[model samples]
Target: MSNPSIIFIPGSYVLLPVYQPLFDAVSEAGYEIKGIHPPTVGLSSRQGRESPAPSMYDDAAVIAQAAEKLADQGKDVILMGHSYAGIPMSQSTKGLGKEERRAQGKPGGIVQLAFISCLVPAIGSSAASLLGRFPNEKRPLVSIDEDGWMLMEDPEATARMICQELPPKEGEAIVTGFAKHSAQSFGNQLTHAGYKDIPVSYLLCEEDLAGPPDFQREMIAMIAEASGRKVDVTSIKAGHCPNLTAKDETIEWVLNVVRKAEESRPTV
Candidate 1:
């Protein structure tokens, strides 16, 4: 593989701009990388107020469309997701793997599915199910209004959880960055299990408060059990929002991933 496109799916309610440093750095290093927004995040589209909220699949469609577009152009892709985005990103890879597309005489396809302190949910489980129903002990809580969008009861506290390593004042500012995302995206059961067929990597945020290290390990174990192979793992001593809290390190780590990916074959 050579210079594969790197597409990153941001966590729920968080917009793509937060990953600007990562994108800029990767691009500067001579690889194409994108940070895309899922339709459910509302500074953009959450449908009309009267319209039903978007599901995880809607998010999945946005991701799939962006990735396969690169694939169609004969560009290999490295699909990575952060936090809640893992669900949609994984679901997005339905028939877009390099081997799968090549089998159909098509060029380009996803070669890597990388998770950055993300939720690796089970098939038939929604991000909400794994989070809402069986959430990690350290995870913070946010309410959902009748319109089905999330409400952050305390953005300050939420920020602290995600950016635990940062100073309280600096972390507090990032609270405004979180948007009102569709609650339905969390509730919807995933119809597709894309990770099972793809080569996978996990960037474990050891100090994560949103999804603790134990939770991260559990998610990694799920893939190993299903695929009978351990996911390639990398550790970063940061909290949930490593991209925000540990920007420089995250950028360096991602660049390394790009270099290795470019040198390797598109095999899982």
Candidate 2:
């Protein structure tokens, strides 16, 4: 069998660079790793001034395209989504699983999904709704720009909410890198629940203030109930950004998931 490839989808307002450490670690472990920087997060200056900003659907399409490219090369793909990215990650892998691709005469497709301190919404659920807001209301954590983009509100708020456990300087650096998020993404609903058919895992960040442990537990339970299957879960004592605050533990959990996926593959 070909070596598996892992594609990482970062959280809202965060670019691929934010996960460099985790990427390096994964690469060093002898697995191929790719990071998808969604255009919906407004990282590109070209999208900054565009009207009718991009949505989560656009983000999912980008992710799906990347996965398809790897899958075409006969690489078993594993998707790792962090924070708000869980939604897109799940959506992108829908109907693109190994089994589904094999039926379509393709070489490979997504084999597993890993959600790290992230939203695990049901089909047709929007991020804003999952975060405890009614339709057309402001999202819980961040402030919105006049042009329909979302901002981190402030560095202090980001520190308190997402990276409380990190060293002060490190947390500050993360905040400084925050970019505007497309407000439209929050209202876009997921069309498919990939976890229902895919092997799934969730890493609960116990010390996460932004995505509280209790809520993460609730999402896990909900997913299991909806999918009618168990979701492998592991807990780590870290802030929302476990890849940064608890790098070693996060990588260990990721590797464990990969090993399990490999074990489950059929022998020739």
Candidate 3:
């Protein structure tokens, strides 16, 4: 069997400049890994004024381009979008060419899509619209600090709010790098709607305060309805950045999806 290639897409505000930990985790399980580093508002950018909006389209382009490359190598690719990355990846895989689609082991040509605590947009919905539904009165549990560096506002409070299930050390690292994202990015509705026609699975972070559970349910239902197929769901008891704190377990669940996807492929 060929090694499964998975692409790690990071979530909003947080800096995943390096995906080696995730890469190592999946590789330890016998899978090859790569990451799509979309352009982001550097952590140094001033809050509100910085731009995370362009990164969405930028990331989608990265996903699409990466799929083409993997297909050329005859490797099966799985697109894993964490946090807000789901929006770009879900949009990117809609209408790929045969070779591009097959690289992800999607027999018809595209491999399956996975949403990692990432919001799945409604057919024409924007990320901002999804957040509006959540009450903003409470201060953010994680955010950027005064130096333009990202950090958790209150470590203990944040741990309780987002990663009560994770180890203290792992949770602390996540909060330490919790950068502030551009508010405008969420408001920009995805221009692509191909996700409705592609195979998708979603991983939910049960304790996430950023992309809350209620919203995840709403978004998942909407994606399922739009695709005319049920969206697969898996749960991880962490915050928005599970890939950072729950790497091993998350990769295990992802492998399960990959196996299922491989089994469902038709002999061509």
Candidate 4:
């Protein structure tokens, strides 16, 4: 059997920094790892500012193209999504077949999905809905600037949104790199979640302020119920980005999921 390959998709308004620790850990565990940079990061407005161009649908299109390429390689592929990227990753694994489409066989092509402190919404929910509304009915995703950067409309507010249990370093990083998100991306609803039926797992960071451990649990329970399979829930005592605080455990959890998926693949 060939070595398994893992694709790491980072969350909203940032590059691969949030995933670096986890990816490094996974690489050390003897699996091939790749980072998928959806233009959603730099293609938007400054952090907590306005968006560049709007459209989560456009983001999904880009992600799906990348996913198809990875899926075509015929390696046991594991798609792991962090934060907002989960929405697109969910859309990427749709309509794949296993073993030439055996009679009523389980869907294949994508082996598994793991969401790291993300909002993996049900088929009909939008990102805006996930974040809820701000005062005066303003949407959080609409605060991008002209150059498509996202920042906290109010730095203090952004701080509060992500500051519950983060360390001083993480809070500083969030202030520096916090970019704006496209309202269109947040508003872009998924037509169907391709990863909905795939075996899935959720990693909850118990001390995370961005997504909060409590919220993470709720999202996991919802996705698990909707997918009609119990999610393999793993809890870590880190902030929103486990790759940073709990790198070793994050990598171990990812490897476990990939190994399980590879083992579950139908043998020829």
Candidate 5:
């Protein structure tokens, strides 16, 4: 459990840079942090093309490769997923944690999974399924083009929903950096449920308009029921983007979970 690598997966339409503060804080606290920018979120002109847009499975494959590399170096990992990125985060870490690798006489496997106001779906479930259940008016914040790519319809509305606590300029920066997300990923079912095997923590953003508190609780309950263990949950009074709105608190909560995971690790 010494110096585990902290890998972050950001939600749809945003890039890894948005979590720079959280990354910096974790780094300053003496932990390595890696951000996985999902290909599903077309962050570059190359990715924005109609032809070669990536899906959730593709995103998970990329993350899984990263985790494997870290595991090969004998470093345990903490995989954190934000928003829609949770799907790939959970799916990617499956059978790649220290315990799982060690069981196979290999090194490096994920030791913890952290969901930050992210979707927690079961095996065979898709993030879109959960999102689709929301009222029609509340859903469809993003418009999906004919090419099966998704984009924010109104940046102002998006900012108010997820970044309401941030300053106008900072919120605008997030909006400006918005990318086109692949619609295929939304409907892709997860092959594995990492939370069922790996230790998990859920950071519930109470003021999240995208993922309401009650819905988060329901997801947590679902996870607990499926896993046959209670999922550790920490609450923050912020919008969807807590890493931006409540940076310091988010860091503390993350570190707290890291410490708990370290303590619970089996001593060799």
Candidate 6:
């Protein structure tokens, strides 16, 4: 079977194009690769936003829209998200499962849910809810005002922490590209628990300062404990932004998972 399409939902404060290297590599391998900048991130102004500002559900809707477009074309998808992206990406797959969609006479659906050093806040929980509960040194961008805007006093520190494994210049550029993300993204409760039915995999960044190895393990365990599913974990010695620091490795790992998911898919 051919490799399935892979859609990547990037983390907070990051532009989707930041994953260009990974996207190029994955696409060069003859697979469809796309990345989305969630609405919750990088909004120049929230003065025109909804009453409470964009939340995880808003982000999930964007992701689900992309997946639905591909699935409608009879293309299977491997939904992969990074860092804070996992929360919304999890909700994006509701009713988009192969079996579920097929029952509705749809041509395609999501095959797997993949993550790279991400947060999987349980249904009814928000990323803000998990703040300070886990031990992490590089927790720079946490609190936000009622305005729902979070600005980094020292974006340099965040760049160094999240993309420490990358080149010094590259890390600097990454920080420059960061925008003020919505605090409501952290506080809003996640509505869907898509992982309960979908197959899941995690690419753990062992040396991530922002999201420590221990925290990643706990997230994996949370999925296992809550869903009763063993999340396939592949650890990489990289920082939080593995797609940039360890670009080659990230591309290859993504290809492997997509291939596996495509191979195991039941024909509709």
lDDT of 6: 0.82
In order of appearance, the predictions have TM-scores of 0.92, 0.92, 0.78, 0.82, 0.93, 0.90
- Candidate 1, which segments miss by more than 4 Å at Cα? 44-51, 133-141, 266-268
lDDT of 1 by residue, 1-268 (tens): 4578899888888867778888887888888888887778867322223455678888889899998899999988999889888899888889899889999999999988989999888888877777764544555567777778875656778887888777887776676666778888888887777778887888999998788899899989998787776688889899998888778888887877777777786356
| lDDT, model 3 | 0.67
Residue-wise lDDT of candidate 3 within 221-246, one digit each (tens)? 88878878988898877776666667
| Residue-by-residue lDDT tens digits, candidate 6, 1-268 | 4558888998887776778888888888888888887787765421223444577888899999999998898888889989889999898899898778988999888989999998998878888776558555546644455667666656667778888877777777667767667777888888888888888999999999888899889889988887888999999899998888888889889988987887787675
- Top candidate on TM-score is 5
lDDT measured at residue 31 in model 6 versus the true structure, 0 to 100: 88
**After superposition, which runs of candidate 3 have C-alpha atoms over 4 Å from their true positions?**
17-19, 41-55, 97-109, 141-160, 166-173, 178-180, 244-248
On lDDT, the stronger of 1 and 3 is 1
Q: Across residues 1-268, which tens digit of lDDT does each residue of candidate 4 receive?
A: 7766777777877666656766777777788888876756663334333335556776666766665565566555677888898887887665542332233453325567878888777778877677673343432223546655445555444544555345566555564565555546777777777555677878888887667677777778787677788888888887766665566787788888888877786687
Question: Which stretches of candidate 5 lie above 4 Å from their native place?
Answer: 44-50, 167-170
Candidate 5 lDDT? 0.83
Pick the winner on TM-score between candidates 1 and 5: 5
Query: By summed lDDT, which 10 consecutive residues of candidate 4 come out lowest?
Result: 133-142
4 against 6, candidate with superior TM-score: 6
User: What is the C-alpha local distance difference test score of candidate 4?
Assistant: 0.67
Best of the two (1, 4) by lDDT: 1
lDDT of each: 0.81, 0.83, 0.67, 0.67, 0.83, 0.82
Over 4 Å off, model 2: 44-51, 133-141
**Poorest stretch of ten by lDDT in candidate 2:** 133-142
Clashes of each: 0, 0, 6, 32, 4, 0
Model 1, TM vs. native: 0.92
* Winner by TM-score between candidate 6 and candidate 5: 5
